[model samples]
Target: MPVPGFADRWRIEPVGAMRVPGVVFASAALLPQVAEEEALRQVANVATLPGIVEASFAMPDVHWGYGFPIGGVAATDVEDGGIVSPGGVGFDISCGVRLLAAPVTLGEVGAALRRLMDRLGVTIPRGLGSGGVWHLPDAGALRKVLEGGARAAAQAGLGTEADLRRCEDGGVLVGADAAQVGERALARGLHQVGSLGSGNHFLEVQVVEKVDDPTTAAAFGLSASQVCVMIHCGSRGLGHQICSDHVRLMRDAMARYAITVPDAQLACVPVRSPEGRSYLAAMAAAANYGRANRQALTVTTRAAFAEALGTSAGSLQLVYDVSHNLAKLEHHDIGGSERLLCVHRKGATRALPPGHPDLPDDLRPFGQPVLVPGSMGTASYVLTGVVPGEAFASACHGAGRTMSRHAALRHVRGAELCRRLEASGIAVRASSLRGLAEEAPEAYKDIYEVVATCERAGLARRVARLRPIGVVKG
Candidate 1:
């Protein structure tokens, strides 16, 4: 079938055996960038895959990526010989966002904001190969984290049980076979559990400035005067190594299975194949490690806040934790029939609507909390999921990068950007000046616009808006 026409900025065409047509959402303002990017081509390639049920979709933030676009979504029928692509999961497996609410208000911390920022900068390690506060775990302990996620951390007395309830999949993925993980992957992950890895990763202290949906905001434990912390990281080198190892394995398997794709990066095998099952198991293990990593960071962050503010750690509570880069087994209604499918979300968040069974009991009435982190020195948003939307109940993960690190460094000056952010009341800390320039606010799209689009498109509804008070980046 020919793609339904819309605007000149986007062109979509159906491929063989696609149950649904492909959709590309872009604007005239972004046409040149989209045209030059490989993301659109990847979208077409994804549509050619076996068992792809609905449309292969790309958001306005779409950019060139390994196999699918950075902002891509695809759902495959698991029972119909569907395939799982390592490229779909990306290198940073379970790379996600975690948000925390503080008992104190912004006014209470205003006078000490600078001091706190400095103290946090000194306490937290950031940058390449930065070691964390946790001792490296042995193989046995590492397996526990790979299988138990934040629940394991809670059992170790790192966080409260409530934290697990607020995290997606309760901070764990079932069927994780740690035995399938390599020794090197285990070693790299053990010590890096609580560390914030470099490249667009950060921890920010923010103040809730606006509440768009009062009922939903209340359900999420967020209020206009409340302060929150957002952490963005992944499974570190462990996840990267898993992806690398499987991509090579899958490339060979693809050829052996007589599968051909437009891009080598899109290498994949049938979901029922031996190689596919193994990759899923290892991926789940790495994803669990990522949840535990965030939980560990939360423990450290709570301690830091308590000591700095002369309060108790119990005063800090988890709001939500969501994974953006992942593939999950879910049931979604299609053509009036409910069927199980594997949904691949790369740079996209799972936004389950209100009353969704997967949500915690307390939060089910409001909907799933979606954390959309902006680039450094900008505002981030807290949104709630809604039903009957495009892209299989998913939304953009962040204010997607509009420029590359190299491009940003060439065009932006680090010192000048720092001064500008400081002038706006945001304290900035970094290990490298060049790194700072690479994550400059100008390097990303306007987050407000992105969130607004999500709302208008019915993917998610805005609950609260937050502006940065302090930022620590790697």
Candidate 2:
């Protein structure tokens, strides 16, 4: 099949043992690159898994990854032989984006951008294993974080009950089993909560440069030139440790279950099986850790902003928080019947359309907020979910990485990129210049093109566009 340009989607007809078809959403110009990276092969490989429903889907930002392509979406039937793969959730479980809208504008903070950024830099710790944000005190306190997520963080005086509803799953995944998590995994992340991780993860201070839809902008309390904070982080070492732990368990269990996948990275077990339940429970606990992590960071951030900008932290209200890497058992219409499915969205965001009951009462009328952060010094987007989305109510996460970190570092010096971004009015602060170079804007796909493709593909609808003023990376 020659890649399509104008077609809505390019379908990969099943061959051999694929259980379902493969679909890649990209423009004709992007299709060649997608193929060049062999991301399509990963999509096809995902379709071979047991109990895969409908098709294996990829967003326009699709790129090569371990098991499923980055931006991959796949659902498996629980009633059938549905299985859960660790690769589907990625190593950074619940790695996601949370955006806070502020009443301030660029005019108000533009002068103090450096000071504000400096405060944020000192407030939020960075890099892998660099923990110090919140001292959990002991393992039992850590267990509360794993079990209760942001709500627990709130109870600890981090935020408030008002913040709970603003987060997805009310800042808690109900079924997290902290006991399933090993002490080693706990040790990896117990102290890392609320800190930004290395590579890709960042906290950016931005301004709403454009409001694509006034009604949505109003609903989201966003206006042109209004300042906002975009936080992109995850569960830190805890999630990585959990994923690594279960991949080993599942790899061992697969033989006993008589299951085999096209890729060893795609190691998995049946969702209803004992191993599967254990993994899910542990994953949930890690996810809760992720939520609590972001919440703590949010509170820390609010204080930093207040001290730097001389405003109350309460003024920085949360717009929405959504995880891009996760596996959630959601109900969807399939074959004319509602069935529960383990929807795995790696490097993808959930785009539930307007009227979703899960949406908070304040945001139900507008739709769930889909936060897509672009590359360094690039434009981020705030989108509203579209009803009956094409890809399991999912959308692209970031402008999916276009190159490897090594490739990016080889292409440009971090110091040079930082100078260029600063010259463009974006204040850049990174843990290291070398790390900054690895995340240069050139290392990722065009956010505009990617979001447009998603809109064209009916995955999400744009609401507003965010432009960065200051950035801090880990």
Which candidate leads in lDDT? 2
Q: How accurate locally is residue 28 in candidate 2, as Cα lDDT from 0 to 100?
A: 73
Runs in model 1 lying further than 4 Å from the true structure: 1-11, 15-20, 27-33
Model 1 TM-score, 2 decimals: 0.95
lDDT of 1: 0.84
Candidate 2: misplaced stretches above 4 Å? 1-7
Which is the leading candidate under TM-score?
Answer: 2
User: Per-residue CA lDDT of candidate 2, range 26-74, in tens?
Assistant: 8776777788887999999999999899999998888999998999999
| Per-model TM-score versus the true fold | 0.95, 0.98
* Alpha-carbon RMSD of each model: 2.3, 1.5
lDDT of 2 at 419: 89
Native-vs-model 2 lDDT?
A: 0.89
Judge candidate 2 at residue 306 and give its lDDT.
88
Q: Tell me the tens digit of each residue's lDDT in model 1 across 11-69.
A: 47675644456676555555456568677778888887778887887765677887888
